[model samples]
Target: MRISATVAAVSGALVLSAFAVPAAQAAGSDAGSYRADVAKIREAAHAASGKAALSGSTVASPAADEPYALNVTFSNVKVHSGKPIVVGAAAHVSVPVTYTLTHGADVDITASDFLTGPYIYKGTYAQPTNMLFGEDAGTCTVTSATTASCKATIDIYPGDGDLSNVDAGAWKAGAEAIALNGQDPTSTTFDITKVGLADQGGFASPNVTRLSKLTVNAAPEPVKKGKTITVTGKLTRANWDANNYTGYSTQPVKLQFRKKNATTYTTIKTIKTTSTGALKTTVKATVDGYFRYSFAGTPTTAPINATGDYVDVK
Candidate 1:
């Protein structure tokens, strides 16, 4: 059972390394959750144009069974990647490279093979492939194109991974010496320190793998009990490829509502997922319970539950 670990696999090539990391450590179990760590290196850090810092946590080799976090700063980074494309109704870019393609970053020496999937976080880790895609950071060496610099075009809002809780027990980052590159290399260091969950709504966490941020926005108003309130929302990050795999986007989302101050919300409506992956539905807001919602659909991606949840109001 070779897990497809590194890079993209040619059309029908056998993918063995894909599940390497998860398989080796847990051998059929998901790895312990990790958080982004950055406090240790924050002491001597200074704001310089060439300075950048990254901090995050990883599963301790079964030897520890605890979350391990580390922080490191990089200088003179050369950013590499194809290009960033906006996903759905968000102001972020989604890296559209598959596992077979090679994307290079100056901070990391080994040109990263396209990512495989997020297997360890959900259930038991698979063995075979022995690879962990879309997580961890790397450092690289540059040949000094004279203007050699370190660049990280974070298309997946706050880098790919999961929806990290801001100010919670989730991952956090801080960057100084900020520079912005238009449709290209950004020349500044930005920090995601002390950010609140509300601010990171449209961003993903450094802990999880996949950067799918879907926000269901609704007006903040009190609803009357036993009334039919008009419910409307806009899905944030929706991406669908109907041609690649069989039924990649199938199960639809059921939109329901609860009372503003009641309990036990029930399904009052349903909305089907579109080819674009974003769905805007108008449902009936039943009862006066807390406005809660969720998606009854599931995805073919990795990291346990590919099925989306209620991103917002009831």
Candidate 2:
């Protein structure tokens, strides 16, 4: 009886050992995966820090009320790790952009940050089938949210590079080697044009070398007490909707007005535009009280779709 009991105990121990073997192996695998994740994150952060280094002339270029595109050129980048980097292996890099506002007080600025295809700033554009995995939004100022010239952080990851440099052995099924997608480095365009602000019209072109650079401004609208009128005044702005009036945080209710037969317009008095569009204001400069105005300009980029309203000039 004693011998039989001892044999049973050994049998139970053997069964438990067999089960433990697989769990131990799985733990080892989990550790390896964790190490790989850490390495990849470190590599991405390093890449972004490098992008922070640029000459003053390189990052920021355009002056205020000027149209410019900051073109960042990347020298061919090679991955030193002979290990394969997956499609999503990303690097974060920030490009420096400089805008010197000639008339900061007078002009409202609209800007957006984007790298590859369509972005959210000026309006969302269609992202292409072969879009790169990078984005620009570090320091962004648009008509919707205007700000002073500041540094914007951007993320740049790969869609391509060269694999021919790696050893063919590293390309083996179970090995790591750098494989590339060979796409262009990427570009972020910043177009500054005068909108609803006071303008003196001497906006110097941004200090960037480009094939074509242009600036189109909005003509000042007329000041009126109350009414919804088609604002026809300056450059040919493509998207001309009341929704384009992007001042999100300002007091929504006010007495608004434009003048009759005026080249430029100003606020007549403080009045709130009811759902019916009505408002009031107390200002000195009063034009012949036509009380409404709109804008005219060519939009290199389109804002959202919206309509203007007519309010009472009470």
Candidate 3:
């Protein structure tokens, strides 16, 4: 299996690249070569930002001084079906990616040594603050002699240092391809002239948000009509650094209600979370219904609705 690599900078920018190294080469002596090359580029990018350097292992072997640019372009790229990617604290999240590839007819994307896939990045492509990619190369179907439609997946693991809290926001989509052209990647004298590389950035923008959760509880399951009912709940969101969920404080949350037999819920009141993300409010018991807490969500956090808690009125 091809293992994914993540390049994380001290500025907390994480980069994931889906450079296609064959399964065999990925496990060999030079396994670190491709990653090292990316790390070096990341270091330069960070230095340009006047920020701390990126953290990564040294390159096991030197890479080509330069790679020949290939004739290729990526277009009509869409990520996560045009929806935000909401990732939780622990479990890995796999996002689907689709795009159109137009390349020189001579480029054999299907070759075993050729690697290509779509990625999402923040900041300029040349000096991205963060990037995300997949563990596998994109699967393509030829639409014409020079054009193809492709699909791939980008996997995110919050616990694996693949993300930080600051990473939750808008990201731009891009694509990259590398053709080894039969060169021995493990060889110390690997020739750069035979390598072909292509990169296209700023195709589309997608949102990535931290997963959010909510809970609702109405006190006194059976209450007399016109009596007071205490409603309480909590709002929490993923904390990437802690690998867990924590309170989402000071955010507005709505209390909503629906008649037992109703199909839709009506907003009762809007309240903000406490310092610890706790929610509490009181409503009069008038009829039989269900209550829930709803969050509208921010750019950095996903929207969520708690399961309704039913209450009986006697």
| Candidate number of the best TM-score | 3
Per-residue C-alpha lDDT of model 3 across residues 1-314, encoded as one tens digit per residue: 12333332222332233333334434643334554333333333233234322334344433325456677778999998899899999888889999998889889877877666777876565456677667667788889888889998886767776788888888889876667788755568766556666667777766889999999999898999999999999999999988899999999999999999999999999999999999999999999999999999999999999999999999
lDDT of 2 by residue, 1-314 (tens): 00000000111110000001123222456322322322232232223222221121122322223212122111112222222222111222222222222223323233211211100011011111111111222232332222333232112222122111111111111001111112111212211221111101111111111011112111133434343333321111211122122221122332234444445445433322234222223333333443332222111212111222222233
Candidates, ranked, TM-score: 3, 1, 2
Per-residue lDDT of model 1, residues 35-107, tens digit only: 1111111111211111221222222321211111111122322112222222222223333211111222322
lDDT of 2: 0.21
What is candidate 3's TM-score against the reference? 0.82
The deviation in Å at residue 106 for candidate 1 is: 41
Candidate 2 residue 1 C-alpha distance from true site, Å: 72
